[model samples]
Target: MAAQLVRAAKTESKGKPERLRFYYYTAGSGGAGPTILATSFLLLGEEVVAYNKGEKIKLKPYSGMLNIDFGKGIGKRDVYLLNLPEVRSAHDVLGIPTVSARFGTAPFFWNWGMSAMTNLLSPEFLKDRTKVQQLVQLFDPLVRAVDGIAGERVSMRVDLECTDGRHTLGLFSHRKLSISVGNATAAFALAILEGSTQPGVWFPEEPEGIAIEARELLLNRATEGTINFIMNKPPWMVETDPKELGLGIYVLQFRTQVVEITDLSGGFDLALKAADCSEVYSFEDIHENRKPPQ
Candidate 1:
């Protein structure tokens, strides 16, 4: 399949003979490999892949999965340094809405299973807006940041977050123009095949002239690995949590320690003498073991 795509790409460029322009969506670990390959292609003068623009392709219907890996040494304090507030403001400036109506349903299903069904049927659940609002507050900023960076709507997002003792905190937001890191490689490959040779940053769905056959072929290849495409509804539509979506388990194994210390600057000499005494004590023991006073 890859051979066929390459041949077709070569044949299509028979007359143009220009570098292929490509655009990858995300830059996370998943996207890293493809991005490197695309960049290598450019360096070798084979093709050019940019993040600014490319031929928009229609992705098949599939459910998006958001994976969050949490365990030892992960903490909220660490996540806060990422500057989520700045991200949220940037998204707002870009006219991106963080949460969709379907967003509220993710947490209910993620943290609770059958209980979610029961809660959905409860009058209190229907009447209560605070829980859903709180969830929106937590997820909106995160989703915006992810989307902004990827240059495509991410159907699924995964990250580590601090978990409370009882409930695992998780949520999903609507994607406007973000792609998953998992899809980055495939997206770039598709762009190269579709003959995107333009410059500047671009979304995968932005360009035209992408053949349907080529689009389907590339989309299939793109989704083959750890990536998935959502054609119908978002992953949260099923009312499942990150764990249920095949996301790994969340475990907290990190602890912080606090130690108190007193300044000894004024008695530095005495402290040095004490240290010297300890060293001398060790030699004295050795000397005593060997011979008296010698």
Candidate 2:
């Protein structure tokens, strides 16, 4: 993706005397991944500008803030995680928003707020005071950080775990700090290919130059499948009750339309089905008899 961006920038700047400016607006885990890519482009002789929290800074080769060791095998490796103490200290002295594993401490509270309600109402976790205290300790820093905004002094620690599991991969780690490599890569690609005209900060999806064709191509490539780009249109234009769309799920049941494709093959379908006690299911089950319900 970085290579593609460099190529497009070079192509666009063929005759112009001024250098093409590349700005990478990154926060959270992007400070670890996208910063590296931007720094690589800088080393490759592309005029690149990198920013974190709207402050312009010099781009350095991937180091210091984050560290990784490639000596161990795939899921069994040690990563000297980010400097939490330094980060906390900076946030304390500079009055900047304290960064949580997620974007900011606000999300930690958001999750805790929802979880607290569930724990209070549900019998599963409410019975044990120790468990509730443990959960509180885990999130105390974030709460304190919020309180610190009002001139209160507080100390907090963030725990890091290294295990032989899917969590080893940063992108697929727990939701609190998970990063989507595909989305990030596509965002950079689109931003470069479809040069942004807007001046201030905006989401990749909000930009104008990225046409529907580019979006379709990117979505298909990233998802590795044909996409049905549904939009509000004719045919499926009936309105229904608001409760039909379940919580935490985004769905448009009215005025919906599907995009059609003419030439595509080797595509696959996935489905789920009910099984009986007599039926034997294998891990590699792909037979027509096991076909999923409509």
Candidate 3:
């Protein structure tokens, strides 16, 4: 997918990529109701940006606070990726100026361990059951709330736009993507896709987040199947009223149409059906399965 986007940008766009963005929206259930916590960061030529309180805000490299709290307030907090290294060097190779990425659960990913340490350091931890639970959840909020935070419910999206505002390339996997090669299992979300380096076969959701170059190499390496080039258009939201609502009711209330432009390619006849993979979602239903054999 990365290789395809890079090819489109290089051939269709006139100048360098204007920006690069990455997003991870985890689905969850909480007190208010079922809550979906979405965390995203954008990479501009000179700075980083995040969406908070309905506006775009700038953030520093390692010091800025990118808010992940989405009002429902389950594990609401502002932490700078806990000084983690989501910022990668792939931009240099992608022709984008920078690749600054900060996820919504990053703080929790590293901070959960902090909770363990905090309890260990406190001599009274053995006697304080309430304190132990409180401190543990306080530092690692999602330990108990796992609906959307972990597993297949987590969805990811990537965008690459040209500096000229002429092209934008986007890829969205509405759930976790995992692949198995021999004995090793690779989950796309587990790896941050730091650099351009890979040499192997590409799975449907290619678990490795294997380098962009390796996927394109499938021409001679492994092209026994088909590739899908999804084009996002028409009514993106398909609203359905649950039977519990007495036949006519809308559960979701908000909608935003993503407007991006860029080059897109590939074929969409090969959709994988694996019970183990969390992400086997399709942006559109136009596939070979729906058509008569040629």
Can you rank all candidates by lDDT, best first? 3, 2, 1
lDDT value for model 3: 0.34
Candidate 1 Cα outliers beyond 4 Å, as residue runs:
1-95, 99-155, 158-183, 203-219, 227-229, 234-236, 241-294
Clashes of each: 25, 0, 7
Whole-model lDDT values for every prediction: 0.27, 0.28, 0.34
lDDT of 1 by residue, 9-44 (tens): 334433311111111122221233333323222222
Supply candidate 2's per-residue lDDT for 189: 71
Residues 34-90, candidate 3: write the lDDT tens digits: 122111111111234443322444554324445432212122233332112222334
lDDT of 2 at 76: 14
The Cα RMSD in angstroms, rounded to one decimal, for candidate 1 relative to the true structure is 24.0
- RMSD to truth, every model: 24.0, 21.8, 14.5
TM-score winner between candidates 2 and 3: 3
Q: Tell me the lDDT of model 3 at 173.
A: 28
